[model samples]
Every structure is written in C-alpha cells, then in structure tokens.
Target: MIQTLPLALPGALVDTHRIDLSALYSTGWGVEAHDVAVAPNGEVYALYGVHRYTHGVADDEADPATANLGYRIITRYAADGEVLASAVCCPSDGDGDDSAVVNGGEMTLCVLPDGTLAISARPDCTTLVAPDLGQVLAAYDSNDRRPFEKFTPGDAFASSISVTPSGRLLCVTTEYGVWKYGNTLANVVGVADGPLTPASKPVIEAIASLDPAPTRYGEDDRRDHVRYQGDPVGFDHRPRPALTERLAGEDRLAGWRDSRLGRPVPLADDLFVLPVYGRTFRGGSRGRPFVFALVDDQGAMTGRLGGMDAWDDSPFTGFCFNVASDPHRGRAFHLNRYGLYAWDSSGTLRARLGTDTKTFKPLSRFTLATCSPAGELLLVHTTQHLVLRVPTPDDLADLAPAVEQALRTYARQRTALKSRWSPVNWHWTHTTTVHHL
Candidate 1:
C-alpha cells in the first residue's frame, strides 16, 4: 500500500539563525553535548553553557564544582547572532574546593523575565545566574544539610521552570512537587498555595464507556502501590508529608510520572503549548503524548486542551514546541524529526516546512526558534562553536485562546482525534479543583 505523505513547502518557515555552540560545549577540561540548550525570551535566544576558558588557571587547576574538570557556562545572543553576554553558570565552589559548583546541575534551564537564568539537573539543586551569564545570583537545594527542610532530594529535580505574568517563579519536578519562589520560600501564599484548580468547578460524573478506553501507561506510574487507589491525574500530586508518614491510602507513593511536559516552553500568559505531564512506567510502552493547556495567573493546570494524532501511532521521534518569549510573539510549531507542522487555531494542520520524507535533513537537533527581526536570520552553531546568526522567518502569532478553546472542544466533543481512536469506547470524566489565587 502506498501512502501519500505531505511535503512541507518552505513557505511554512524560513531559515532563521544558526549559532555554533562548540565553544560553549567545551569544558576546557570536561565534556559537553554536541547540542546546545536554547531558551527564547523574545528578542534574544539564550544558549546554555559557555566557551572553555583556561585563561586564569593552569591546565592542572580545575574548578571545584565541575568534577574538578571544566567550567560551566551560559551565553545569550542578540537577534543578529551577536554575542550578548557569556558567564560561568557552574562556578567553582568557594573555600578553594577543586570541583564545579553543585548548582544548575546540567543542561536543563529556564530564562526569567528579568533575564536571569535558572538551571538544574539534579534534584533540589537550582542555580540562578545573571543574564550576561556573568555571576551566580542565588542557589537552592531541597535537602540541604545546612537548612534541613522536611523535603526530600526527590522534591528538587525541577525538570521544568517558567515565570508567571506576575513576576513569580514556577517550577515542576518529574516525580513530585510544584514550587513558586519570589523572596523567601513563598509556598504558603498566593499561587504558591496551590495546584491551582479550575475556578468554574465543572461537574464530573464518572460513567462507563460503550467501548473501553485505553488504560493509562503503567500501574505504578499512574496508580498507587496497590495499583488501584485514587485519580492521580484528577487530584493534586504535590507532597503531603502527613500522607507519606501514614503510608496508607492513594497518596501512599506520593506523585511520580515520566515526561513532565512536551517541551518546557511558554505558549502564552496563562497558557503553554506542551505535552502531557504524565508518562508510562518502565515495563509499559512509551508514547509521546502531548497537549495544549491553560493555567491560572498563578500558574496551575486548568484543563487539557488538544492537538496531535495519537490515534494509531506516533509521528515524532525528536520534537520541540515553540515556547514563546518577549520581543517576538512566536507561533506554536510542532517540530518532529521529519519536519515542522504549524497548526491553525481551529485544530487543523495549517502549513508545514521541511521534508515530507523522514531522514532527509541530516540535522541532529532543530528548534522552532525565533530572534532578531533580521532577514539574514537563520543561525547555525556547528560542532566548531562559531556563534553566527544566519537569517530568520517572520514570527507568526498563532497560540491564542481561540486555538485552545477549539482543542478543548475537540477533546470533549470527539472521542478520538482524526477518528484514530474511538472516544465513545473510552470512560472519561472531568476533574476539578478549588481556585487558589
């Protein structure tokens, strides 16, 4: 049987800028990935890590934090592919220790409104660096021996981070906990006092489906130790130490899941164009389940909006959602290993740019990135680490309320997307929470 796959007309996107992140990846004495970690904040795109510099110290002298090897760096670039600034992210631990600092563990990072950088790899370890990547601003650990909170190291692995419209820091861990920070540990106030549920309080009525819907990924992944307890998705997954102490009902295992979001990028003020926050257990299958969703001003899950075809199979190998920033109101782009798919607000494929046939482009990584209102916009940073902004595409404004409303409607009205799965066969219900903020 022959299938006609669609070809992506270049009109869907233009070659923007490519920057060489080699110098940034070089540890001078350690190692780094061939790929660069990029965060979009409107006009400039910041890539995590910086050049390997051996200027001040001898080859034998190593930074105390980086396993006593290389320097941790972060750099920001202007739209024209010019170097905005570069600074050490994981600096040497003071006291003349011969190792890299324990903050901002590795490749994971987020850019704050004030242009500050938050990077973390290990659980509960966060390092805040100045925008220029110049100096360390603040650092935090959940299980710090000095401050000793009741929290575990598991509570600090922030896989995702975003700032709400209100100058508050929002972070989510893979297993458990969602945290918001301002001055002190503000987890008890405002949005911090949340798993911000929907205000409308939609009525939820559980009913059996004419056709049984597919079960969630795993028993342990979604269910409690007994494998049948409570609604992991419906209820709040935040830490309840008392619940853990009791070791009794549904909250027995606490909260744990696979992928936290599709890709951690902001879609709008109170919205994000991302994938599902849950994942399959080790013994089950792996599916790339993505979704569009809304959040309250304080940043909490409001509802599940929709997109993508998970009917029969998954079309993505490697992918990224265009999480927007300031300066440019970039549209939402779904970049699979094959190419890019742009969607209209009405839950339909609008345009595509790239190859119809997979494996056509020999690119390891492709970010639906935007910066520089420059014509020569496409920037390519090669293995050689040359920072150059090549050229760009017109920033499309797509992610709107209408788009989410359409998807939300679709997820509700239709049992399956593109008739790939039967909705009537699935047992589903709406879950609600009290509005915190």
Candidate 2:
C-alpha cells in the first residue's frame, strides 16, 4: 500500500512508496541511492551505487567470491512507482580503474533539457545516458581532458552538475573548482577558481599511485572563469568518521552518508546553486556548515547563500546533504541533520519543516531531494528504501503571475534548444555494463 502522511505544514501531504532494493543490498553489498531526479515528463530516475562488503567473514575464509557488478545503476520509474527501465552505465572490473566498485561516494544526477540523463561519480566519471535508460551515450572523465589530466583524481571529479536552460553543462569538482562544458560533453567553455588550494593528503597518494604517467589531453582553456555575466540571484548551497565516536559500541553507523556535493538546483536564467559541505579539522570542531555557491552556466561564482553555523549551539547540526529548488516559486529546499529548510531566492528563510516527530518521523533517513516539473518534491528515505513524493504546501504559494510568466519564458527557451541535440548511438565501451530492460 502506498503510505500517506501529513506534512508538518497544513494542506500538504506526503506519499511514501517503498522501492525494493533488497537485491542490491543483499548480504555482501551495501547500496545507496547516489541521487534521484524527476524528468519533465514525470518519469523518475534514480542513480545508485552497489558496493561490495564482507561481514562475519570467519577471519580467514577468503571472502566468498562474488560476481563482478557494475558500480552504479540508473533506474527509471513511472510516476505511479512502477519500474520502467534500468541499465548499468558504469562498469567495474574490480581493478578500480574506470569506476570504483567499493567505497565510492559523491555522485550527482540531473535530466538534461533534451530528456537525456547526466550522472557523475567520484574520481572523475561523468556520463550521459539515453532517455530510454538503456545505455551510455557519451562520457567524460580524467582520461579525456587536459586540465583534468594534470590534477589528481579528486581534482577532476564532478561532485555536482546541472544543465542550463541553454543546454550548457555546469560542473563542480573537488580541486579544479567549477567548469562549464558544452551539452555534448565535447568541449569546456569556462572554469572558476584555481583548483583547491594545496591538494589534500589523499590526493597526493592518488598521484603517486598512477602508473606509466598520465597522458595529456588537447583542449584550449577557452573562456576559463568568466565573471558571472548574469544578474544577482539567490540560492544556497560533508563527511567524517565521527560516526565511530557517536555510535560507540553500536557496531553500526547511524545517519545518512552525504555525497561530496548535493544535487545542483537550477534557478532563473543560466544560474544554479551547488551545496558545499565537508569535515573541517580546525579548532577540533567536527564539520563545516553548508554554503550555497551560486554559479551561472559560464562557471562563475555569482553569490553565496549561508546556512546554519555550529557556533549558534542550536539543537540541530548545521550540516546539509542536498538541496532542491522550485523555480516556479523562486524557493530552494535544503536537507540536513535538522530537517528540510525552505528559502527564497533572496536567501531568506521562510520555513523549517521538522520530520523528527508526528506522522512524518525520522528525518535522518532522507538523504536527498529533487523537485519535479510539476513542483512536487521527490525525496529518498534510505533506511526505509522508499521514495516520498511531497507536494508543495499551501504556505509555499505560487509566485505572482508576472514571476510565473518569467519562469515559463525561461523554460520555453530551454525547449527551443532541445532541437540542437539528438540521441547518440550507445557506442561507449563498458564490458561489464548490463542493460536491464
């Protein structure tokens, strides 16, 4: 039965639909939904990673041999929760070359204006899957680009990505900052910041482990870090092993694992917001607060939206995992240890809906959220293996007619660009990728 619950806000109800993911997380595997995105046509696409694990292993039984599985899979579902199609776009050889079969994190996904899907996995793997959800159409990774070739794997990773209404691709990386690429994933149009200051220790290890020296990629820097040419707009934008200390002897970690970057929320014009959070060792504090970096399709940082700060000593932690925006309402939604937060484009907090009590309990299980074309929210509850469809509350009323018209205008601009793109043949090589129709 599809379960429905009253949201903290009046006149709003949430529908919970459980997704049967048992097969993906059976005995020796740990699976997580990297991200969930809803297409304009009401189809849902979820990107998940099935990692390998061995528990209760007799200390010497050479872990039971397991079949090689693709590190990640993108599943499509109808609005009513019926499975539509699924395919493994990333292959793992268990050699950790192309994709990580285990211990991979920080992936993001978004549906392009042309109905295709774009997904990014850690260590620099970004692929565009066909609309039918059957194959990978094009791919970009550390192996294919120049600036990407010079840095360590983390430097090239696409922590977050969003396609502009004009069909440009905006991406955020660990070290190289943000980038703007052509929709075809063929060329880079811009860049921002100079790679993260002084690569971290882990990145150093990755550099030393590379064999035969990395090859160079030939591409001009082009329009690197063009200052935000668009008008000002509002938006908003962690991980740590502190789990061991908190859980004590529980033998398990509680709470959701946040990806490196939350899913990007598209806003007016060519702008989008990317949430940034991570652990900070300074002053012995646990983690950093969330910051919403507002950038346009040209890879320029326009403005930043602030989030909760730890110093406030508030009951809830200031960290957030993901953010979704309702461009129609000019509002953005952020999820954190506290609950779901709603903010306007000007960065004003309008509401904070707590899910820790009442009909909507256990906010900790929801790892991420994506807004649908119809203005509904698609949230993922990991612990329950469910997806919750949340309608906009009455309090989040529609924008003035003028503002609504502007949004419609922006969307129309996107639709006109769709003709520039046509589906490509599934020619990428992924020996282990399975097409699960």
Candidate 3:
C-alpha cells in the first residue's frame, strides 16, 4: 500500500520564524520543556520540568521541604524570541509512591483572554499568573484528589488546558472528558464527556500471549533487582514477546485506534478544534485516524476530518498531532511528520504543507504548540530544547519554499546549541520563586 499525503486544498502554512531554547535545557541536569503556548500578542510561554535525581534515595524518600526546590520552570519570551521573564512554581516530587510526601509534577499552560497565564500545574488546581511574573493572581482548586496523589490510575486527570472564546478555561484530561471553567478559575461550568478507548489493549494482550523465551532479549531481567528486592525469581516472561510480534501488534493498533484528543484549539470565540493525537500503524494497516474535530461553543462536535491518510508510518513524540488554530483566517492547523495540514472552520481541508528539509536527518517532532492571532505557529520540541516560530502562509506555492527555508533556519539555530551551562546561575536568574499553595 502506497502512503498518500493529505490532498492540498486552497491555503498553505509557511515556516518563517524559529526560537531555540536549548540554552535553558543545558543549564539543568535533566531539564525538559513539558509544554508551550503562544499568546495572542506573540509572547511565548513554556512549561519546563527540571529533573533532580538523588541516585540512592527515591523521590518519595527525598526531603519534602526541598521538593519544590528547582522543579517546574515557566519562561515567557517576547515576540522576537528573547527571554522576557521566567518563573518557578509548583512542586515536582512524586513518582506514584503511595507514601510520597509531595505529588505535584504534572503541568500544562495557556494564556487567558485578559493577558494572564493560566496554568494547571497540579492535578487538583489551576492558577492565573500575572504576565510580569510578579505574583499568582488567583487560583481555582477543584477540591478533588488526583489519582497521582493516591499513586494509582483512575478515571481522568488534567493533561492540558486552553482558553475558550467566552473567556472560559478548557481543561483536557489524560482520559475521560474535557472540562470548562470560568475565566475567574472559580467553578466548573461544564464538561464534554467521552471515555478514552483502550486502544492499546489488543496490542498489549498479543505481546502477553507470547511464550517465555529466557535470554531472548536479555538474560538477567532487571525485575529481580527492582521489583523482587533482589530475590532470585523465575524467568521474567510477563509481556515478554518476540520482537516481530510486538512490532506487528503495535503497528496494527496505531492505525485503527479510536479517536483521542490531544489539546483543543480555539478557532473563534464560539468554535474550537480537537486534534486526534496518535500515530499510524505500519505493515499496511490501512486504517486512518481522524485528523481533527470541530466543536461548537457548547462543546458539541460540529464536523471532523477523517479523509486524509499518510502513506508511511513514522514514529512521533508523546502526541502525534499538535494542533493550533489561526482564528484570524478561520483555519485550524495540524502538524506531524507527514505535513502541516490546514482545515477551514467547517472542517474542510484547506492546505497541506511539508516541513521536510535535507539539512536535518529527521524533522524534530514538537510536543506542544500553539498559534498566534498574527498567524505564527509556535512549537516546543522538548527533547531538542527548541522553541520554534513559523509563519503560516495562505498559498502552497509560497509555503513549499518557505518550509524548506524555515527548516534550514531552524537547522542553523539548532546547531548553535551549547552543550552545558551553569545550573545555579540559570535557575537564579530565570526562575522566579512561587509559593506552593
């Protein structure tokens, strides 16, 4: 089966701007950009997770007092890509240990209508931070306990947040459904309900069905040292399948899984687009996932794109589809390795722009991204420590060449990244102290 790219419709998205945040990542031991958002005014905000490892002691065994020490970093950048302000907030000291003193690692960000940054840093609460990074303006706690607090998976937890046109905050969960809260962060106004599909269940069971072949992958499996307290155990066979079988199962699931939303993109005050975030299964699994769904103000699905399908399977990051809407043009954009796809408000394909360049061996997959009113697409590549800006053009002819040029520009920017920096000084200057409420 030959993979075919999405048909180009009428409009195009061109790459024009780029920002490299590798400097900040180099400053910490295990710093990562968890999320990124672009404000209407062209300002960029990023959620950074700074990992601190106490080798001998686990996260729970570590001191709770220092749990919030250097964990969550939020940086604001100007339209020109200069670091404007950066702050440190929220605790990041939990790893599903029931006895863990602090459980506050997960976080996501979005800018509110009033020009304030809204952050769902903890599972139970969301905060409104002043643009100047001076203070936490207000906070809304759902008064609910997250599964992570109890060290177990449950119905759903906040995975990402966005602002609706009506000045309400939209919270997308890891599963279950999406929530709508007032801009004041006061109360839950509504919810769009849907349970997550057990998309990986079939693949998981196939892998589990394999016969136990000791030393197939490795001899001394690490389960004994990690799970059994060094007790000599039998052959570790659970979920241990042949490499070919595992790959085949994984590929099949990727192509045909039910739709899952990554983050909702508001195209207007009354319209939003939800990207179906997942990868394509290889081995001729012809199923094609829906690209995105258009929703009304009431969170009702109006239309969706299920026509496009890629020819080849390429590995993507945490979220396969990163979506953002250019409300000014009434268009929604979906980004992946295959291309950048655009759809009109009515869910019609408007354009398909490529991001391929020979300068980079493989194009970096951005984990988080957002669009500005001025038609700029801001992308955050966590592993690459890159914050990129690209211009969204309306014509494919213009976009095709611009894509190549912009990618080349990004290549140059990525190449200039230094290997290391002073963690202490970077934290002191770039991270503001926020009280853990």
Candidate 4:
C-alpha cells in the first residue's frame, strides 16, 4: 500500500487522508480508469484501457489494411495497495487469420464475495476471469455457440456485471439484453443463449408491431399536404420571378422537413424497463428487479428503501454514478457530477446534502473515486489527495464519550509541556546537550 507523511494542520483542521493508488501501478499513457470495485477484504480492482479501432485488408489487393483497432486492459491491486496482476485484450497481428478488426470500450469490474474477480468489457460482451492470485490467467471471451456466425456486424460490448447477494452474476450489454447466470463465472458463460434474446431481434419485432407500420418504399404521400394549422401569412405569391432563390429556398425547406420527420421513433415500453442490477433474495420475493428492491441472498426484499428515482429538480436524475453503503447511518451515499446525495437501504431519498452549502468541495481533478467498505469517501484527484469522512449523527453519538475523555487528556498534557522548550534559549544554544550523568 502507498503511504504519505502527515501534513501539519491549522487550527481545528480535520485530518484529510487519501491513498495515492497510481504510485503502485504502471498505467500507460492515454489510458483512463472507467470503474473500480473493492472486495470485502479491501483489495481494489480497476477496469481501464485505450479506445481505438482496427481495420481489415481486402483480398487479392495490395492496399494497406485500414480498420479501427481498440485495446482493453484490466488490473488487480492487492489489499495492501500493490499491483498483483494485469491483463489486456487486443487483436492478434499474425498473418494467418484475417477477420474484421475488433474494438472495446466502457469496462466494469466486480469482485464476488468468494474472492473471484469479474471484469466485463463493453461493445463486445466478454467477461475475463481471474479466480486466484499468482496466476497469469489468459483472457477469454464468454463462450459463443455461433463462434463462426456473425451475430452483429460490429462488436458486442459488455457494459456492467454485479454479483447478487446469493452469489449469482448479472450482466448487461450495450447490444444484448440483460442476463443472469449461476453464481460462478463458468456458469455465466454460454448462459446468454439459453433464455436471453439478442438486442437487435427484439427491436426489429417491436418496430414491426407499431400501429402505423413503417413503409419500405412508396410515394412521398406524407409530405405533399402542408396544412397551415398554426397561423396565416400576411404576404404570399409576390416574388415568383427568380429561379435561383426558389431552388435555394426549396432545398432549405426540404432539409428542415427531413430533420423534423426523418428521425427514428423509439420502441414502446422502452422507458418503463428499468436496468436490473442483480438478482438477489431477501425474504419473500424471487426474480424481482434489483432496481427497486432491497434484495438479499435469499431473494427477499428488506429495509424501507427500494430503487432510486430521478432527481426531478436536479440534473443527475438520481441514478448515482458510484454508491457506497454506510451501515452506521443505515444509508447509502452517492457521488454525482454535481455533489453528494444519500439514500436509505430501501432506496428512499433520505437527504440532499452538500449541493448548495458546498461543505464538501467538489471533485475537481480526481483520477479515481472509491468509497471505503466502511463508508469513507476516497478521491485520488491529484498526486496529493484528500479523503473525506462523512459521519452521520449516529457516528458522532458513538464517539461522544471517548471524544470528551480524549480532549481532557490533551489539555492536561499541553499545559504540562508548555514551558519545556523556549524559542529564545534554543536559538542561543544551538549545540546544547542534555546531561543526565
């Protein structure tokens, strides 16, 4: 683990501390960390990589190959803050195999309670597994039944994966719908085919099911009738002499019409479908949406909280980019681009703090953000960082008695040692020595 010396504090200064994690890893240039997961034992795993695209060369042609090539990398840090392992996913440059170039983006990492690390890469739904330490595990894609068959023309990126309380894994993709698999990473493989449908197929069906069916080819019937529904013009049909003006005006009018009508319509029921976090058990409910449920290992719902809603008056929309549970306050704290917000375990919005007050400084330049399993907020914004501890009223109450005793002892010690060192005497006798003989 990386450590730094304590800073001299001003009067009544709160002790701000943060661990500089980059000091422990060799993160390459042009790479940015996307997400981080901390294990129960305090080990931190980060998902990060470079974004690029690779191209393919044509047959029988001497032309240079041109395709977008991207790289994905994953690294694991030990509990003590040492880089234990690292892995990258990239296209092979060998001459034998020729295929379309691959690309990856938007990575996420999660550590199972049993100590397995799950790293999910997006735009291509693949999960790399690192089950134990000291082993250089070769990265593998989630097993594809139709490995030879092309499902989508481009890459299928995996977005996020979360481990349920019962240990099952739930993963979502940019193109493929959400899926749940058995607790282990092996079970999650190929399970995507059994019950889940690819994202494209369902969308095509939904479009076909629209009431006013989309036309493949026909005359421009919808455009001819221009009903003057709003207001009547004061002047018309006066300037009909210039051909160039008419043609230019026609082009501008046509462009505006196309912009208004040519947009693709969204599928129905799309907005109501909430993104599932994971399938977990608490008491009674089974296979419930983790979005609005206080789920536990038994698939039962507990606590007074449910899923969070959009912040109606605020910009963040209430969905937290990162969240940490504070059992001491019975709440979960979140950090958005704006400020901090808190919700109860039941997913109820408890308080909107630090927005207007600015009691907590904004995260201006943090490279990585993590919440301690114990509920402290750690931000690695700079080479020198700051850690903010937000204690609830209950935390203060727990420390009340001890705080009083510690203050009394500090006052007694300070008074006893006040006159022991004099500034003038130290300057005059620079080589003064203590004599005990």
TM-score of each: 0.47, 0.57, 0.59, 0.42
How would the candidate models be sorted by lDDT, starting from the highest? 3, 2, 1, 4
**Residue 248 lDDT (model 2):** 30
Off by over 4 Å in 4: 1-29, 51-70, 91-103, 131-149, 152-159, 173-320, 323-330, 355-358, 364-437
Please, what are the lDDT tens digits per residue for candidate 1 over residues 136-197? 65554433321224423322323335444454444443322222111111111111212211
RMSD over all Cα atoms, model 2: 15.1
Error of 1 at 341 (Å): 2.6
Error of 4 at 273 (Å): 13
Q: How accurate is candidate 2 locally (lDDT)?
A: 0.44
Tens digits of per-residue lDDT for model 3 on 318-437?
234567777767777666665666677777776655446443323446532666667766665545456667776775336555555666676665544322222232221222233232
Instruction: State the lDDT at 34 in candidate 1.
Output: 20
Question: Candidate 2's residue-wise lDDT over 1-437, tens digit each?
Answer: 12111111000100111112234456555555567777878778777654454464343333234333335666676666556655653444334445322123466777866687767654345566677766556554543233434433222434445544444445543322222221112111222222211121011011000011112222322112222233111010111112112223422232212213344566644566655443333364334333565655444556655455544322224333567777666677766555566667666666665555442334545644577766666666554344566566535533222223432443343243233322112001112223532
Candidate number with greatest TM-score: 3
Cand. 4 TM to true fold = 0.42
Instruction: At residue 375, give the lDDT of candidate 1.
Output: 22
Q: What does the lDDT read for residue 63 in candidate 2?
A: 24
lDDT of 3 at 90: 47
**Best first by TM-score, ranked:** 3, 2, 1, 4
